[model samples]
Target: MTRTTLALALAAALALAACDRGPANGAPAAAPTAGAPQAQAGQDAAAELDALYAEFWEESLRLNPLSATYIGDSRYNDQLPDTFSAEFRQRQLDFAQRWLERVRGYDVEQLEGQARLSYEIFVSSLEEQIEGERFPGWQQPLNQFYSFPSSFAMLGSGTGAQPFRTVADYDNWLARASNIPTLFDSAMANMREGMANGVVQPRVLVEKTLPQLDGLIKDDPEQTLFWRPIAEMPEDFPEAERDRLTEAYRSLIADTLMPAYRALRRFTAEEYLPAARDSHGLDALPDGEAWYAFNVRRITTTDLTPAQIHDIGLAEVERIHGEMRQVMQEVGFEGDLQAFFEYMTTDPAFTYESEEALLADYRAFEATVDARVGELFSLTPKAAFEIRPVEAFRAQSAAGGSYMRPSEDGSRPGIFYVNTYDLPTRKTWDRDALYLHEAIPGHHFQIALQQELEGIPTFRRFGGQTAYIEGWGLYAESLGRELGVYADPYTYFGRLQAELWRAIRLVVDTGLHSKGWIREQVIQYMKDNSATSDTEAVSETERYMAIPGQALAYKVGELKIKELRARAEAALGEAFDPRAFHAEVLGDGSLPLDVLEAKIDRWIAAQS
Candidate 1:
């Protein structure tokens, strides 16, 4: 997912409706009024901004209960309102519009620094949500990559963000789980509408989703993934509560969750699969080109068209391929670019002996990189992080690594899940760059530090821009050399491989949505361009298929950051300080690429 949707969708799914009293660091939450005296204005404005922010956050959670859950709030856990319903969807749109209007009326000039920027970001995001209603995203929600079936399997496995330790927890899920049948029925209806309207997913993607749903359907309640809560009910619960919750959960699983999954599975396999499109491009659907364009703007936060992004991707691919060729020469590989890719993939020396060794290697890189963080960054996060394998149920289709943000209360550490599904694809060469991007100095550092900022309003602290966030992640991959991993030629090749993967994403993501590339064609392009194994290639291709413009973020955002950085270094000549430059880039949290560039220009002018 692009950082916007990653944050916004997660916010939609996970943020809760709790009142924000203030900053978690003990600051009082309130914002100052306008036209106060200059001397006292700063303090008053800070307080006023805090109150406005707290209201915004509370309203946000209420509007998007799923977000509240992910942030660790239990207030709406038992309430699974039909988020896909037209009424609820309109309510969400109205919520965004009202909040945008309310916050805009507040005299932001009274606020200073981070608070002002936070206001802009909040307004921009809400406005973007309102604008995005034109696209029919709800019609095509369940894809192979991240449909509710797979998400629930991960949660019901007793290992995800969903908690099952209390009777309340069990009851919450029971209430939530009971709604699955309705959602499934709605999904089948929506897919029918899509098929009639010619907006169906590619046949290949629909085919892959059937098995995922089938795996979740069970004849017996105890055999179902959803039955885990009943199996592990807390011993301390009152007997009445335990007995009541256990029976309710069992019935919910047997009569509700499983049947819904089975029905959806059968419908996809028997009905939708036959009607699914052979064409891959979103542009082929009704208003598909416009939808793809909207996604591009939402993801990149720029007006650049699909064709523009396509050209940029082509240039980056060529540049990175040249670097890989140099790496081939360094390793004394005898043939062309594809030959070197083969050598890297087949070489036994680059493979991990076991999953334990793989995890150990990543942990070791974390320690090594942590030691050097102070050299580059002036700010750091208080939240801790851990490296874990992607949960097995979804790992087959998961990415190499991804970060889950920390709980608002810090009860849970941020998790960086690395998928080790196919051992050879999980190469030692890939680990260093992956570690930097998903862990230490990449997502965990950027997202967690933003969450920990004290004076910024809660929304700003929590909010993100995809370009800035993913741009930072891609930039983090470049730090492998300074962080000490790229000294080895093979490891350096890994960094290039990672970059190449992203570059290929730029090509294929646009190619699928705009240029009419078929599913196999996209998969073929990925396999030809990088050393990713067949399993990894399939997963990555499906990910791009699932989210139309998301994969564009990594390369698009990275290119903008790198371009700006080069400009800054050249303009400053001998006076440039990487540490200070990084501080400026990160200190304000995430911003649009244009906004980021403008801010950097101001910083450069001030330094000069």
Candidate 2:
């Protein structure tokens, strides 16, 4: 996930009515008005809210410089805050509270269309942030999944969101990256505090962090991942500047970056590991029950308790299993579900021979989808994306596939990173669903189109609800047949299996955190229930352990989206347009689930 996604990883989708740019083939959500008084009020309201949102975004960028860099803003590129510090935490809380009050001052009922939607999202997000301050997530910041070291590596390396186009860009990075060691020091201090408070990370996750740090901590700066910019410097640069950049980067990597990595590694292995808890779930810590509950609400953007979500997961899993069995019958597999899973996973034809072949096949799948995607999605993003393997250092702990949204300025294309680590686990059947979820019509479509939306605030464009984002990704996986993939029965099974994995996440995530399930038990449940390989099972289990309530988002979000679509179809009958319904869902950007449902209902009513 992108840094922005992780930062604002809560909420769902919402939009305006189709007649007034709300849904059904209308423009981006904008305030519509009639009469002189109403028009003036609308203008004043829009002006005030727009100004507030812009101010909030600008200050936010200053506070979160990495966010600016990711969105193609370079003004704050040379800064990195010690975000894990209590002082910084206070600043963030104050920021949220202050902004929440400002946005809430508006007469929200008087505001209509996108204006009201923006107000609700801004206020809700801020309120959630403030409410969540009671839980000290900053203290236990180092996880295998979303720690500073991993994100820093991506930014410093030439491949990620940080720009390397100009000589000044290189210099800005040098200045910015110099603060990393200080940040690492702060992280260690926070971890020490967490240790004292009985809030340390699971030892299993900390163990994984060690190898990740080792992969980057090289003796020679030139050998380091951070050295990529210097190595791949553009030939058009003047010799003097190139030489200057090369040495500066070398010094930066060796003196600053590598030492920071080593320090973090040593801290993790020697001091932190011994202090880390053996337990696997968030519920193991102090006030962990409330902490997990807050996460469950925040991640899923719903009041459905952990028990409710767990029951939903069980039902969905059983339903998907039945579907998978039918696919097995279609494929003429005589064995039971487990044996069919084994056949699909271990069959040579279902596995790729090489990383090169895996990437090539994904690229080919993109073309195949593009040819027919128009049939399903008239609402598409202008931004393009590419297929690449995950960086070697992070692939083991990374997801099977993930999408990085394109830059705001369009300098970078969206990236669909397919993990090739443990190549046999990178099943061929999995590619179609994964591609649909992570690339076209999934993240890149929702996120990039969100960024592309006119007349919305920057926060709405960049920040997101996890349920809305990942939910859309999972929902996109179901559109495979419409987009000319999932043709074979086994490939269709891959779609069901993918959905089944998410359903399993709901079970095991709740199981681990709320039900006192062990790490081994979670892994066992995944294997017993799905076609997940040992590698996927382990990594996914740890991911749930790392971020307690996140796994629930995919299933929860997907179910809501599916429900809305079904409602729209039933309401509109022959008049229903899937494309227009889709536009309504995405047109308003990521929203809270209730807001999305309400907005979709309006669109459905408009069509009816």
Candidate 3:
């Protein structure tokens, strides 16, 4: 799953900035004497850059406080911003530009290794953030899938990032929660600007968003999801404190939250929906083609054009389809490729009888794979994770599975949210590979380990490249056999099926955005190419639309990783070790694809 950020229009994990300086607001200081000798000066320059990173991180958290909550920092628990407001967007732009120039003011000649890596990535990330400003994302902040209404509901649900453990925690949320109405107004104002400027979201997307808002609106506080804290209130508080807090939450929900939800719901359904566009592709808006290209650069961290990525996706789809044919022949399927796809998706024998059974089976995969992790990985996270059903509120549009990072303080474990929305549609053959991708050696391992690395600045720990992050997840699926769970031919086919699905994404995501393929065309392409159900095809297609160019990352990333590994194996045949290669790939956390390739090449040379 892609990491969620409260950066509003900013790419969140993919965007932030850094510079030269000492630490700020309690972070470790890294500074050098101004006139030190050359060797010492370089070391000090690197150290000072680290100091800048720490300070940037501190200031960034304060600016986007909800990010702190998501990353498991509690100090900003009481903060939330109206990110949709014009003022906030301008301030964010200034923040990006200020740091971009600050970072460029430093000398890169005085840095090397990870310190240099941090500097280069930090500057690129901030530049992307500033370049992204030309695209009016704040005007269309609400996607059918990730609208603030639903995400805010999740935060208020007492089970999300907003902590509800202590009375102080509850109070923090209350203070933050009370700001919802103002934020809602700001969002509405932004949408109004979008309508005037012909930059509105598609009508179909807005239609989907309406139901999500409907779920959040309730006249009575007790009937709303906001009452979750009250229902699950901590037991330790004194009677008077409990009574007072309970009434306060009730009033907060009824007075502040419900009205906001109701207003947003009405404004969206009645006012905004009518004004939303009929066109779907970003190419339809003014400067839309360039806007999408900008998003592509920001998302993938690469210069690859739509045509190049489209061709790459096509080649991958064709190659994976040939592999699927082999799986069909091995399984002794009677008919053609489409028939085999139908069989894999439709066969009842490949499904669980109940949700409990499905969840229990996934829980069993942990031990099964853990036994063989030693074969491929020398690095493992100390952070624990558990499997959970996708919450009902967002499961319909959520991915088959997603991983939320663990809390830094060990207060919350990383969560693997498996979507059980339609259990039968979730095939038994699908689970093992999905397990590898989302939980085991996929997101959980990569993300948690990145967070756990020693002496890295907060930006490196938390920032990510989608190509590296999701690419690693897809690459991990290829390790199913190594992890000892795909001995069965059908299960191995599941691994191939997962790979095929990602390969298909490259074709369809580009088709919808750049090639003018309609939603139906994308869905039909998916049905023809992969084992995913119609439900999954439709959901995945819309997901690509919601976040254009994002689907391209998986295949582009996986191909680069696989290519690098092949080069390493060929170059250092006698000395090549899979475990060492993996450790090296994951050693410095998520990186841009080119940077990853260079790092692996360096390791191969060292081995020889």
Top-down TM-score ranking: 3, 2, 1
Give the alpha carbon lDDT tens digit for every residue of 1-608 in model 2: 33333222211101100001111122222344555476567667766677667766777777777667767788988887776666777776666655555555556666788888887777777677767778867678888887568778878888888899899899999998999888789889988998898889999999998888888888988888898898899899999999999988988988888888888898899999999999988888888999999999988999999999999999999999999989987878898999988888888888899999999999988889889887877778888789888999999999898888888788898888899999988998998898889887888889889989888887788778888888998999988887878988888988999999999999999999999999999999999999989999999999899889988999899999999999988888898878887888888788878889999888877777
Residue 240 displacement in candidate 2 (angstroms): 1.3
Top TM-score model: 3
Model 1 alpha-carbon drift over 4 Å, by segment:
1-50, 104-112, 230-245, 571-575
C-alpha-based local distance difference test score of model 3: 0.81
Question: What lDDT does candidate 3 reach at residue 246?
Answer: 92
TM-scores, one per candidate: 0.90, 0.94, 0.96
lDDT of 1 by residue, 1-608 (tens): 22222323321323223213223333443444566575476556556657767876876776666666666777877766666666777787766666666655556665666655666666677777777778776677677776677766666656566778777677777777677677667768877887887778888788888767766777888887777777887789999998887788777777777777888888888889999877777887789899899889988988899998888889888999999888888878899998888888988988999999999988887878888888877777888889899866667777888888877677768888888887877888888888889877888888888777777666667667777788889998998787666878998999999998888988999998999887789888888888878888888888887778888888888888888789899999999888888878888777888888888998999888
Measured on C-alpha atoms, candidate 2 has an lDDT of 0.82
Model 2 residue pairs with clashes: 10-465, 12-591, 13-591, 16-22, 17-22
Clashing pairs in 3: none
